[model samples]
Target: MRSMCCFSALLLLIMAPVVCQGGNILVFPMEGSHWVNMDVLLQALHSRGHSLTVVRSNKSWYIKEKSSYYNTITVSVEKAVDQKFIQKVIYEIMEYERGASRLVYLFHLIVGMFGTFLESHELLGGFVSALLDDAELTTYMKDSKFDLLLTDPCWGGGAIVAKYLNLPLVYNARWLIAGDAHLAIAPSPLSYIPVTGTRYTDRMTFVQRVNNMILHVITQIQLSWVIKDVYQKVCEKYLGPDCDYYQLMIDADIWLMRTDFVFDYPRPTMPNVIYMGGFQCKPAKPLPQHLEDFVQSSGDHGFIIMSLGTFVSELPADLANEIAATFAKLPQKVIWRYKGEKPDTLGNNTLLVDWMPQNDLLGHLKIKLFVAHGGTNGIQEAIYHGVPVVGIPLFFDQYDNILRLADRGGAKILSLSTMDKDDNFLKAIQEVLTEPSYRNNMQRLSRLHRDQQLTPMDNALFWMEFVMRHKGAAHLKAQGNRMPWYSYHSVDVALFLVGALILLLFTVFFLLRCLCAAVCKCKAKRD
Candidate 1:
């Protein structure tokens, strides 16, 4: 009995470190595709023995209230930023794209999106307010003693929650309330680092740089007057009148950025920011029997797979028919993820399903090309698997995402306005398929992406665990997040130097004049 007791004590001693490493993490994630990314992180955390609690809306479209990986705290709200709302907004954007001229489309796009953004924020703000107002929920949260809060800051609620709880904050982020995550945390010069909407590369033409500057100013205005205004009210009411919403945003302990150099242009990044672009991707799993048979039937030709992402389930009927007809003509078989009514023109070679295993299909050796809507996740996955893309950019950052790949010689982009006109979609796909350069360039990128010291997921996990172990990564956090705009940009320093230089010049001029007068007086005296 004493020998068994000694053995048990030894076992406990051996396992103590593993048991102590587990952390209690609180997550406030964004909905739709952002949640997909966050879910991947949550799964990794769960596998590492971390306890997770996800705060989700009652009307959440994708986030389930119950999951094996994490417990959920569901907040009730009058409305949610659900799929239906997004679908309606997307439909409106598509209509504008198809029906209007370029000038009119641009005007309507800006104005319409401006209102939509404000409305979305207002809804998210309301949800946050509801979560905070619930005395029981807030009390429970305080008592839970969560080590840190992980969130996607695309919406402002998570940042507000982290501040309210005084939790060590970490972000699984690419977009913030205003725009791209880099603009919020990094030194993004308008000269090279293109703003979110502009589809310009790092090497911009003179005119493009001028346009970038104009857009940068517009973005600043939108952030200050529009986006920041929504969250400022929330912060003032909940935290205090002294709280700055913008600071709360930039003050995260770590940022797991969903981009890498392979997919994104080189730009300034903060120390706490870790690029985990394709962390969610993995080697291809064996396809379902039916899918494998389909792939095998393609044989030497291989196959093409197209998915426009979660929000765009179906295109307009005419556009769908046009795409279907084009796919029918291709010799290679096509697997399309579409939920719209069957296009009368859809060929026997084309198979339409409601969903497809996107990453798995991308990694498959038999897959030849990807027809995508140019989402960040899709593009990164394409790069990860060495699959070339024929891009159809719909809205938001889709154009910019595709432009990066096109500039890198791995993609062909077709604008929505011209996708159906003169067989543009078909031609783009054919070009990507027939051209050897597209595959070769993308394969090279895949090698570069894979040639990393540590896997992106492993790197992300290390940083997350590091933050938990250290209470917060305060050492890694930059003080720039705490500085005022004038201080951060060094505007005051520049002005001070300019003023001092002017004063010195004036002093020298006055002294020279006095010297000349003295010399003339001496000459007169001598005469």
Candidate 2:
């Protein structure tokens, strides 16, 4: 047992309930800064005196950022976890992005194709082989004997490792809006729940409900295809065929969902699903001097910050110029987060930089508008700071994120494809800038979000320790995951009932026919 003396100032209060006993935790997070929620989670675990060893891909951003309580081990695979591959995932999304009027159920096809793509991707196979094939790494993990393997199931590697070592697993996924993973794990009521990236609300229309089913069914089918046969093969290759690859996911001790009713729409989560939506958002610190100077100079008009997030590319030169040209017409200064070369048509009002402290800048009082890629984290940060948004959404969940904010009256969507000639794109930027209701509505939501009983990190820490204390939190897991699809959805029961009703109807019809014939014969005899 580690002493509570290792805890820092921020953790002292929360660490009280814990008895200075914590497990050696292994975190296998997907690669990127977008895993911000996961980072906060690991930090909280570390703060509570847990020994954390994170296995990072060479490309992971967290490899260099290891602190006192945690260590990082880097592994180099033949096929690297590159941003280009992630970008390709986005581009393939473009394949289905077209003609939404005709392809209303496009997400199903997108979901189907994407799973196959990821399966065939060299990175997935290479990483799995690299880990399992490396005798030293596997031996080290076995010798160290971690009690818990913490991972976001979004990355299959986490599940693989947990299954291989027969460790207790906790699934973490970042989506205030529940995705297919959430549905599989718990009692996700599809009736009101909007399908991820679909932009529907809980009270979906009949057609929307049908579309939701399409998204859910197709996603599940695609995921299932590899989950058992292909994924199990990977496990069997190394674990001598005894490892139950699918069972690790099913037997997960807890699911730490990065969402809550406070930030998300109302939905019933499972007993084991812990809400930790705003864990990534910290209190804003002072801006860097240059940024502070720039914002201060904007004075009453204030500055608008535009970021397309970490992985997405900057706008095309022509499009960037067009957006810049529009911005030049307004009095407000624009800080655009773009790493690409400066466009020749760059306007005087725009300052293009490689990066900006997104959360800190959003917190700035002088900020007027946030032009963003409509990622959840960006939207969450904007809401946290009570800043209205002008969202130019890119692929994946961005459309849905922007739509939700727009529906809330705090944002306006300006589709990137239409930005070149569309008056609405320019109008949206102006509307969010000049509108008072946007800010007012945003502030109302910000207050509601902050009015929660516990902080996101606290909620996460409590539940994480709860899992640890109880020795894997088995009681909280629902039996629904163990049931077959036919049983879980009650399809088999419904079919049985339908068959019985059909049989009863057939017998009744036959009896009625016989009685009618007997009555006719009696009538003839009496006549």
Candidate 3:
């Protein structure tokens, strides 16, 4: 009866009429070329006549233009943050920290990132200050009163801005599932929804569940005590002495996660989380004339596209040489996206370019396999195109992303640390290329992904617009958000059942003892 009542109420809320009007949106892209999903969303919103002003670093990749259609606010972040230093911190921990366990690496990752945050914009004066320090920009924002904030919370700048300006902040994620989502909004079962640090599947072993749960609890503590303190200090310095930091996040509008039920495991989700995994992908464009000729020349053999995305533009020269030699013996033509010095033993069967249209090449009919670092965007694109992959994961979520695809039988994962043995790369390449099953598996995955009733982009836009129209969609916020941990895990219920059982056993034992004593006394009297 209660469930039916709740369902009816929710239906009324959904059916409630809202004014379908446009909004003034402010977008802050994460500091990189990796904002592919967010970029797609922004373009779609722009096309629908919402006024958008995007803030990004000068070093970032954006469509260069000046137009009333949308605006760009450039801030110089090169002096504020070092990309190479950040990358090195994560890489060294993942690669050379052999003495440390995965959990220890996660701890160190948090510590390293925390220190990095303290040194960077989450301070009194840095890149963030640059954004607000601009008198013209701040004045314009104050006047404009942006109705919504589209931001990547991983960057930390967005959350600060949303609180400072009192705007509705919608968090954007590239490929991470963090604990903050569980504590802040959803009911995340740690046994199924693995932490960002671990690569456990939906069905986790007992030990894996224990570790994931520990990570989940510890992450919230770190956020509450460590990260939140720094953010509060920053807010106090700029916003006001009485500024509310964490509440801004806990009460934020929505979470635009780049996840789909097709790619990810079945798990509970919040009303605010909108999953649109393949938003970045589009219908494949016709190949360039030169590339068309190159692919055509492969004849019976096909080609492969190899890229580790923008963050990993270079590799060790020795590793590059080995990769080139491995591809040389294969019948497939390889388009290797290498920005470093060319390997001396590079072969004629390979075409080396600094940049390749990865999605387009994957869509090509003759493209056999993807040689990737297992970035989420690359994985999604490969799934979209029905191409099997040879994954060379480097750091962070790359290994995890590959794990998911490999689990689905469409990709084979190779460890970058053990790439010294030539057979590791060669065997993986040969297996994925020769096995028809890999191809068939990927095609099945593609069908599942492409079979959505509403297109991923349309689904994303609808939820976002719905939120905007409904004045932040508080009606959609889950009522269970504030339930205590014990209730969430059913710990209280278990305790109650145990207590009741103990009481019943004690009562039965006492009654038996009384009866035995009474019977003994009566027998004694009769004797």
Q: Summarize candidate 2's per-residue lDDT along 1-527 as a digit string, tens digits.
A: 25455556448767765658777888877666546667777777877778899887776543554567678767776566577766666655543443343254364446555654555433654676777778898899889878788887765667778777878778787531124456666577777787775668677999998888877776566566656645666767767677766665567787877666645776666787777776777778999999898889887999999898878655556676787778777788889988777877777878888878899998888999999888778888888888898887766678777777777788887765565675666788888777799999889878877787898778878876776666688788778878877998899999999999999999999999999999999999999
Better of 2 and 3 by TM-score: 2
The TM-score of predicted model 2 comes to: 0.86
Going through the candidates in the order shown, the clash numbers are: 0, 1, 0
Clashes of 2: 1
Q: After superposition, how far is residue 49 of candidate 3 from its true place, in Å?
A: 2.2
Give the runs in model 3 whose Cα sits over 4 Å from its true position. 1-22, 58-69, 75-78, 90-125, 133-135, 174-184, 238-244, 482-527
Q: State TM-scores per candidate.
A: 0.96, 0.86, 0.82
| Model 1 stretches with alpha carbons more than 4 Å out | 1-13, 17-20, 522-527
Question: Candidate 1 residues 66-108, lDDT tens each?
Answer: 8999999999999988898899999998899888887787677
The parts of candidate 2 lying over 4 Å away from their true place are 1-18, 59-62, 65-69, 88-116, 119-122, 175-179, 189-191, 239-247, 498-527
Q: Against the hidden true structure, what lDDT does model 1 obtain? A: 0.90
Q: Name the lDDT value of residue 480 in candidate 1.
A: 83
Give each model's whole-structure lDDT: 0.90, 0.74, 0.75
